[model samples]
Target: MEALNEELERAGAWVFGAGLEPASSATVIRASGSVSMTDGPYAETKEQMGGFWIIDVPDLDTALDWAGKAGAACEQPVELRPMQRA
Candidate 1:
């Protein structure tokens, strides 16, 4: 895990979040005519997502570089999302 963080740092990106939490503890929020909130995640099956990373980089290649390392650390899926431009 430390090595992954270092790699990202060296590449001028940074991990934003990470952790393990129960599926039941998760709540999904969506928007439409009115705000919508749902219980648990959309996927109720196992292989639940436990963590995430937000990295600032020029493009996908940089993001993938960090993702591969994180994936190995947890031996599970790691989701990546670009910081929204608002």
Candidate 2:
């Protein structure tokens, strides 16, 4: 995360958001014959989403570029997905 943030810094971009989430803070809602809200994880899991980042870029290549940098920067996993034009 530190390294990735550094790359963004050199590029004049910054890590928008990054943090950890607890499994307890999450709730799962489902619509069935009756709606239900469950405690704890909607499903059993080990490690949940720890953190995330949102970076503004011009296009796909730019997004991928950032993702690659981030992946290399952190020992943990990193993912990148293009958002629909909004």
Candidate 3:
């Protein structure tokens, strides 16, 4: 993880990432004229999001390159998504 962050810094695209609480510790809230609270994961799945990183880069290609590096370093899948235009 440290190495991945370092690589992002070297590429001048580092942003920030926060570690998430365990899914069991998460709380879900819902509302539709009424409110409800669920004490657990938002849904059941074979996988769960552990954390995320946001990077600033010039374009999609650069972002994908960085994401590939991240995936290689962590031995886990990495997803890339472009932020909506302002």
> Per-prediction TM-score, please?
0.62, 0.65, 0.83
State each model's C-alpha RMSD to the native: 3.3, 3.1, 1.6
Candidate 3 lDDT over 1-86, as tens digits, reads 89889878887898887668778888888898999998888686667677789999998898888889888876779878888889
Task: After the best TM-score superposition of candidate 1, give how far the Cα of residue 17 lies from its true spot, in angstroms.
Answer: 1.3
* Residue 66 displacement (Å), model 3: 0.9
What is the lDDT for 48 in model 3? 69
C-alpha lDDT of candidate 3 relative to the true structure: 0.83
TM-score of 1: 0.62
Best by TM-score: 3
RMSD of 3: 1.6
lDDT of 1 by residue, 1-58 (tens): 7777777778777746566687888888889889999898777466687767677878
The CA lDDT of each predicted structure is 0.76, 0.74, 0.83
Q: What's the distance in Å from true for residue 32, model 3?
A: 1.4
The CA lDDT at 18 in model 2 is 74
RMSD of 2: 3.1
Worst lDDT 10-window in candidate 1: 11-20
